[model samples]
Target: MDLVSTSREALRIGAVSYLNSKPLVHGLTALEGAQVRFDLPSRLADDLSAGRLDVALVPIVEYLRHPEYQLLSSACVACWGPVLSVKLYFRTPPEEVQRLALDEGSRTSAALAQILLAQLHDVRPQLVQLPIGDSIDDVEADAVLLIGDRAMQTSDDQFAEVWDLGDRWCRWTELPFVFAAWVARPDLPVHASQLADVFDSVRDRGVAAIESIVAAEAANLGLEPALVRDYLTRYLHFTLAKREQLGVELFAKHCRELGLVEASRSSLEHSS
Candidate 1:
């Protein structure tokens, strides 16, 4: 089934509104014959699924779940270590956790939190949703997962244990972790190569303008420019290369083992 229009129309691009995603979407609005929309990571996934978006930066888990999606570009939101934006706070010991509350804004990080807990401690706790705009205080659970800007601002003083999911994954697997990627639905009106180039070009420009991006975004996110700069440069990795691809494959394997995604289908489609 064709998911996109047959006629040439403005490409509908969706991106996350978080600070971590700024580098990937910088100057994207200037693309010829393209329209870009900013949304939550999870919402972007939904929009892509419903054919409302031609391509979107969606959670890696979302891509793994849908066999029809193709990796549209090398641009991705990844982390080598200590991402400082995706965190798990444990009120009780990890192994003893009986209930885990997941942030409504996350799909990939929620799965990662479960996978890490099960792999490291052999625990599979019951899951609960921490609705958008709600905090850990509003959720009754042994542990809570938080992502994006909110996770960075959260304090760890009250938690028994705080885990930066990216750091934990790297320490456990010795590989980088890919959280989200630019994915496109099958059978688009545009050539895959052409669209991929547009996405990659914007990503390169965005990465090169990180300093200016930090300068513009810091005050808006209520973060100091230094911290934002370090977060972008030190904690986050914007390109999805060989190591990052390995990370995605490994994550898909874990998701399969844990029954988080369909086990019978190939989970990724790399761009040619």
Candidate 2:
């Protein structure tokens, strides 16, 4: 049996649209069995939960919300510390902040920010939900959390502090952050694992071709190719490992405290 390409059906897979995610999609080419569908995590989660996808690379928060998904082996889009890609720019101190405007690309970051501010900082900041194209400056929110590619190029004006959610989480909880994960619906047929293999392969290819990915996608995001390359190879991580495990547990705990989910670590684990 080959590790790649066994099934003929296309496996609907959701992928992030940022360069940090380049490696994951790049690695899918080695798969011989599944066809993948790529989209922003928000739409992917909606579709996946609606029974449109078999397996997907989705936001970690999505996995947190849906206990019905099983995580794939040895793969995640995580970062040990400061993830420059997921940043929260503020116009006031963390304590003084009253409201937050969220980027629409990923709702997970918004949830994380609200919970972190409340639990860790003991501040009940109001959350103002806004779509992706909404200008952070125009919003009356004291802070704005932006994620993925659009966030990477955000101008640093009108904020007193810049916080990377990943870094803040690590500092507060001393664990790495699993921003995204490869997950499958619970009781998914054995054939669905074909999509899992596709995700793994493309992720490897993406990692190997970071230079090319940055060269191609950076300009569109208004960041230099070299900077994007550094962020991919140095700032971002592509594995689901030790620190990532800690991140998942910690994140799960935080989510629970925020009333986002009630699932425990033991219950969240899906044997692959």
Candidate 3:
């Protein structure tokens, strides 16, 4: 068994490589027979699909995109009303906003934003894919959707105002926002216990020791440590309950109606 474990090499697990995700994977050092990998959620999804990872913290919709994928643990890298992180910045009074830039790190948030645009409030902003490191002014459009660490790092003083998508979704639907999640493939390796142990380490070290994470990660991103600490502690959550689950389902239904996803299969249903 020891030889088999040694032969396993590194697990090549995938993560966002962002401040928000560091806590979820902070305990990877303690997991035996497993090595963690980090990248954007899109890259994580692509790698996981291509068999580069045993599991990953993929965007929620990516899991829905391939429903055959399984969730190994209940813990998620999510939040209730992630004010500074998952926000949609608008220059056009929210109603007349025309062109919108879509954050490449996002899949579920982009979809949820569209759902709100079409269903909750009639919006038709031209969604443009803006890659990371692309230069664009906040005044370019009436609205632009931003996600992940970059969104959190963007100060309100830099923009006219920021709308927390998670917070707005809560006010509109009264539920917690389900963002990124951990995923496992259908043919999980026999060393699954080690996988569970890895996640156990993440939940214990990452969630429990958030201040250190916020301090370190905020500094790396050139953001105020205090602001990052406030967001991580007051906004983000790791558990999925009845309402968040329902919100997932609701978003899935809306996506199906918009023809964004194949109707034969539903991607919003996040089941472990």
Q: Rank order by lDDT, top first?
A: 1, 2, 3
Q: Give the lDDT of residue 247 in candidate 2.
A: 72
Worst 10-residue lDDT window, candidate 1: 1-10
Residues 1-272 of candidate 3 have per-residue lDDT tens digits of 12136345555677777776676777665566655677788788888989988789887777666767776665676666655677787665666767888877778888877877777568767878867766446236666777777786665665566788888887887767678777878766645555555575577678889888887887788888887887777777776666767777776677778766663243333343
Q: Report the C-alpha lDDT of model 2 over 223-261, residue by residue, as the tens digit.
A: 887888778877778877666776777777777887777
**Pairs clashing in candidate 3?**
91-142
TM-score versus the correct structure, for each prediction: 0.94, 0.89, 0.86
Q: Report how far off residue 14 is in candidate 2 (Å).
A: 1.9
Name the runs in model 3 displaced over 4 angstroms: 1-9, 138-140, 157-161, 191-194, 263-272
lDDT of 1 by residue, 1-272 (tens): 12233446888889888999998988887776778899889999999999999889999999889888888888889999999999999999999999999999899999999999999999999999998888789999999999999999999999999999999999999999999999989956677777777778888889899999999989888889999999999999888888887888899899999999984244345675
State how far residue 31 of model 3 sits from its true place (Å).
2.6
Candidate 1 residue-wise lDDT at 42 = 92
TM-score for candidate 3, residues paired by index: 0.86
lDDT, residue 28, model 2? 62
lDDT of each: 0.89, 0.73, 0.71
